[model samples]
Target: MAAVSKYLTAKNSAAAGGILLVLYFLKQRRRSAALNRKKGSANDLNSEKDGKKERAAVDKLFFVRISRIIGIMVPRLLCKETWYLFLIAVMLVTRTYCDVWMIQNGTMIESAIIGRSTKGFKKYLFNFITAMPVIALVNNFLKLGLNELKLCFRVRLTKHLYDEYLNLKKIITGHYVDHLHNFIFFRFSMGMVDSIIAKYFATVVGYLVVSRPFLDLSHPRHLSSSHAELLEDYYQSGRMLLRMSQALGRIVLAGREMTRLSGFTARITELMRVLKELNSGKYERTMVSHSEKDVSEKLTLVPGSGRIINVDHIIKFDHTPLATPNGDVLIRDMCFEVKSGTNVLVCGPNGCGKSSLFRVLGELWPLFGGSLTKPERGKLFYVPQRPYMTLGSLRDQVIYPDTHEDQKKKGISDQVLKEYLDNVQLGHILEREGSWDVVQDWMDVLSGGEKQRMAMARLFYHKPQFAILDECTSAVSVDVEDYIYSHCRKVGITLFTVSHRKSLWKHHEFYLHMDGRGNYEFKPITTETVEFGS
Candidate 1:
């Protein structure tokens, strides 16, 4: 009858498990269907497809990314603070030993109780009591130390990445700025805050609630006839419960650590990818002058490539075709150049290659199928329609890409910075913001025209030989625009400006007009050639 009852119980358990499996399968199917619906929806299908492609790419590079991340961390671990890591290792070993010792002493106590050896029971109990507090103290101390070490490591990693970001000499695009936030999030996760909290918090709670109950279950009973059996059964039950709780705690902690680690890895890998892009010279644009020698040499534009071709009287483009980064040709076999001191006005309808032409000149875009000449990087400057407001004092904005020390060496002073601001009619900002040294969020505090005027102030401060002002004065009044151009001309800053304003032609000597259909015209802008569509 007992065997029959056991078989019935086993069958019931099996049936329950089968029902659970079916439910789990249905749940998973529903989840997959929901994901498919999101992926197939009209509004999000294209974005979902792109996300899938990105995911696939990430999967392909996951192992390489992991290796790179490890490569970054391992060196720090083995640095001068290597002793700290060894101490952490020793602490972990001590923790494991304490756990094993506790289990062994626990079994000994149970045996002593069952054998009715009062002396043995007392000795084992005293040993357990002595070791428990010491072990707990050591464990907590080690955890605190570990967290501090992790924090130090995170700081070092963040500083290294910041140095890399600063070393990149390119314009800070909006896309790069967005990724900068993601990179900071990655840095914060590097501390493994979740794992630390889980370990300490769960351990304390497990000891308070779990250990107290186990102790209650294992408490000594009155000495009686059934004392040995009763004590033995209770001891065994308490040991099983304690071990089960510890195992479950470890599993939960491991799951949380793994989840945080996965997130940290993804964010770090993406940040590294962006850093690589920022450091690369030719990402979207093809350099017509890139040769084995030039690649091996410095990253500057080659003299023949597009910086200085004075012998030809103008920087020539030999059958050059301009294309978008995606390889769609915008202007084919186009050729033009402005010599030193010759100001050119780039006029075209919206969506034409006027701005793109400046991009090519700025070396921010690739010049395809043509060799062009441009001055060395520092000799040229670009002021976009929406100027970049760097994070610093008003002086920093004007003399950006140049440190205060560099400017000092170049004989620039606070007085000079203030003068440049006055040149752009922004000298009032000095008083409004307190002084040139008073730092503020200039982008937010300054209006649109004020920002452009600040950019012009920067231009006047740098005094580059050639400046590409792409509708930079669109926000300023006509009078202000005239003043800004007059300042540039007075400072001998040759202009390659893209503007629809007819009032700007008087400041330029030549015009390069595009029709947005791979057609362009380049000629002297004289009295008869100043009208639109001319």
Candidate 2:
């Protein structure tokens, strides 16, 4: 119990220190800003205004922070399995009473020794020995209950954060789990500290009541006995000093821990505020066109289409007067359309809007002035330069975005999945890892080429209407790349691929070349175009 108390105290002190540091930093920044404003510079004033708004937002969230902390604690405590909480309360109450009784007995033993009374000493000593076993048993059980409570709190808090605020990727690590546990544990420790202080204070008060006669500053008019007086004086002085020292220590410790608690509340409040903003979509990027003229010259939205993708009178103008999400205009007055079951190869130099054009088509980047017609969301899929592999087995990797139920509904057999893997020449993975159920840290395990090939395998599984291969095959050899493209074509999946490889031109029917200097040319891939190599 003493070891546990010490550990909690250290953690509380550290939390208080963290809060202090954050507040200090914030104070320093405000002071610096004030000094700069006093210099009477317009630029300084403008910068100050921006910074002050952010600071004010943070300041205003203190109440919200407290609310968030309460939110983390209350629901879990009041939850269905609140029996754990009841058990903890009972344990704490038992532990507190036991502590007080032991302290009282200890004080009596001290007085007995000082008085040199053999009989009194033996009586207190027998009481102490008898209580020791029960106290030990209670302490052990209390510790066990406290640990279980911490685990319960951790699990609930983790669910809240993961399900509501943050995604799985950010909070998957053991470090994050420990962070959640510490947050709840600190509050529990504060209650323990309070109980300890109250017990000690009550003990000291009881001693003062009994020793009031000797502690009176005034000299006694009628003495009891000279020897009694000496003993009383000695006891009074020592007890007063010890109580004062203990009180001072408790006050300092409590104040420090409370400060840390405040700090923790501040940090958590800020996080909740951010999460709220994210949930409200307040931080989502605003899509603005390069030119006001371009915004006004909106192309008519094509009524509807069964085509895989369409680009109608798409004019990507220069971003001279204003900045766009895509830095500068690389393709000017670009216009093209890919009907159903047709592939277009987008070719451009570095910094040209090859990928940017695809982003616009995919509705990721803002369309400057054009009618971009595309199929529904699930109908289109993009294969980036780096494919993301989520934490799951190889089966999950193949039929991604599709749950096992969905796969079962579609009647997708393991044999079919293996064949898809075979298409990407990754059939060896099956034999090496034993089966499709084997899970691996694929990001570290797979080579760049292998990862891209795996991505291709995934594409084969989904087989969307159009797949934007954005340099997805750069690391892939020419033969494998050819095979992947051919396979997609055979699957009736129209492709809008961005690549610098000259070998890629033969796979598509037409070419859309971007000149980086706001000019574009589009035409069928001619026999003469086959000679050029990037």
Candidate 3:
């Protein structure tokens, strides 16, 4: 009887120890949870402060910038991008529903296994397997839709930028001024803000509340199920909460991504602003003045006082002030004129407004103050020392700035093009390069002399009224240059030759000489008047 009583006491002691251990563990868990909550609150406060600072640094007109970018991405409401975005939304909703269903299905399966119900387990397992394929399809399609949407956005933005960049007329018209103004005045209504908030509110609240109910699973009577069933429910609830947290984490990550996107948006918008300013013929230059009094003229726009008149068969410049783009006066006042069939040789010392004169004539540089007259566009062609070689076939070299279709429209055949090449002594290239359709990197492939001759061939093909040969034959031999000059005379193409070569004086009727100073002289090129060295 004493041995039996001792065994009972030992058993009671073990039971008491087990109870104390359980109570200690429960207290420790509560303490850990409290510490975690405190850390989380501190982190939340820090994150909120950081987010506000980042937002302030991003842009004051952040929404306007976003709206403009969105406008560029989706010019039309019923576009392909819109369709893809809709599909992505649908997929996200479907995925969320599938997640919920999966959680419930898993709970059923777990309950079946705990109860040792073989039929129920098999039924739930089959359901899980069947649903997997559908889930996989949804996931892949979602990825595809997202990628396509990205591509569409990229294409749209690129095309928009190219349009603004490439269209010279649009840039010159100052259209971007209005666009910038519109962006500044862009209104972000309260209703729209409310709508955006409303869209995400449900998702955020749902995620936050998802784990709340599962946390208090101490009472099995709250659920109309057995203890095993309650355990399965609790397990599934935990898994669902984990998934919800992951989704919430992605949302938070997206906020960081948006912060990065704001940087890119700011850069793009700044670039657009600069381009618009340039398009409107406005430029900013930091002028370093020689004297302190001239500091007020640090930046100035070119005065729009120049007029260009397009008249056939005559070129003239009246009181034109030749200036560089930096607002430096190259020539204060200049007057010149040449009628049809009058070939003038332009000669000047370095930086003496020689090229600047032609730049004004070509409308490339803004005319500061002048009344200039020139032949209509396409009637005047300038061939530089280094001619441009386009990317295309051998035939394209001769008829540059004109396509094969344009050549055909002008009733010029490959045979005629060959004749032009032959005139420039480049006809052999056809045989060497295979055929007219053979394409190569012409700039790298052709020699410098060949490129000049090719430009001459292009000149012959177009047969302009006046051609500015700016040392275009420097690379070619004297004989080839003579042939090219004779051919120009034969074709009745007047030439404004800029050269120091004495042999070219015979081909020109007039000489325009500019000293390194602002002074210049325009005179008839005669035997007695022609100065050999000077």
Candidate 4:
């Protein structure tokens, strides 16, 4: 009668498991369908970018998709490491099981070790040896899989962080403005935030480790009644420690989040201050005091790079009491000329405002105490020190600031594109589909030299009449640097470059030097000769 009841129970358990298997398969199929649909829709980006606003929208959507994957994968992966520490626990369980069974007769050593002498000891040793390989193999396999999975997850997470940094870097590089202070603050604050979260995660894992032993009991009253009661209390203390750890981790996370929030709040306040001064017209009276001169009518033209640069004076701000005597002339005057066939090299030591002058010319930042003429806008393109890479394809980065029609009109052929990459040496990366769109794990794919070379490739594609190469080739090797300068010189791009290299000096026909005391000198390169000291 009992055997019949046991057979029925076994059949019921098997049927329940079969139902679960069917449901799991159905769920997996649904997920695959959703992913395929998204991937299919993602393929038509080029056709959809018909308008300016639509293109911008598509660009944003492209970034959001990459970011969404990163966001989902990160927290899940970080939490998964705690499972590794759990493997140690399974060992203790096996040991406890052996200890319990051995105690069923007398104390383990009394009968098993002493009564039968060598025979009993051999049996025990053989048992351990027989089970040892199985235990070690299981543990080793589990650890190997976990390590490989962790490594893969870690690589993916690192890639995501780089993606986030690159995206934010683009916005930070607006107008080529110097935002060194802002960058420091941003990285420092975010770093603290990341640290806090990771520490909290570790704390949570520690708590689980301390408490899991208490919760894993098969029977509560196995020992002598008093002994069992004492053991329960002893293990229950582990749970209390876990609860305390959880509380501490939560508190730390909350505090760290508040600190980051404050940093953002301070940025808003600074922007508001700038706005209020502008709205209040704080500089209007000062700007008008210069005899009410017509800055526009004082236009001058030095035709170079297919455009005219009209400005009376360029200066370096002294930022000292003597330079600003009436608290008026904060900067000194500089004059220069440019002809159609010359490259203008702006050279100075670090922080001498070489980059700032480019921004003034680019019309990104306002020029102090001077009037600049309006040139045809599309003829100019500014390349900064660090090339800004976005979350898109190589095609997108290459054709920036130009429309699809413009690209076609400019005659960008496959051969041209491939040749340009080959010149800069980034051809292999672009060969892979979605290589540019592929989220990068590290900027190391291109070395400093490679990045600079790649930037030059973009320069080749754009073929802008005027190119501002502002330390844009610093990371490039000296050989590649000379090659780029040689090419630009040959092409007659009318370059305005800032470099510390003497090798590069020969390529330019004009020069400018700024001393930080608000003093500057501008000269035609034809009249100057610089010799290294003997």
lDDT of every predicted structure (CA atoms): 0.68, 0.65, 0.75, 0.53
Q: Give candidate 4 regions above 4 Å deviation.
A: 1-267, 279-330, 374-378, 401-411, 428-442, 531-534
Using TM-score as the measure, which candidate wins? 1
| Candidate 1 positional error at 186, Å | 24
Worst 10 residues of 1 by lDDT: 299-308
In order of TM-score, best first, we have 1, 3, 2, 4
For residues 1-534, could you state the per-residue lDDT of candidate 1 as single tens digits? 333333333255336434644554466447546766665565365764454433212233656676777566556545734666677888888887887788778877987977889999999999998998989987987887688678766876687677665555331699898999998996677446434443554344334432332234333432342656555655654565456445644654464355456567778877776666656634443333222234443222211122223232245566666655444456756777677678888877777777677666655655444576666667788998898888997778888878888898998778888888887788888888887678888889999999999889889888888888888988999898998888888888888888878888888889888877657899998878846622
Q: Which parts of model 3 are misplaced by more than 4 Å? A: 1-57, 62-302, 500-503, 515-517, 528-534
TM-scores of all predicted structures: 0.57, 0.55, 0.56, 0.42
The per-candidate count of clashes, in order, stands at: 7, 1, 0, 0
Q: 150, model 3: CA deviation in Å?
A: 9.8
- Per-residue lDDT of candidate 2, residues 137-220 (tens digit): 888887877788678767766676555543211116899999999988977885675555445643544354434444443425
Which candidate tops lDDT? Answer: 3
Ranked candidates (lDDT, high to low): 3, 1, 2, 4
- Name the better of 2 and 4 by lDDT: 2
| Lowest-sum lDDT 10-residue window in model 4 | 318-327
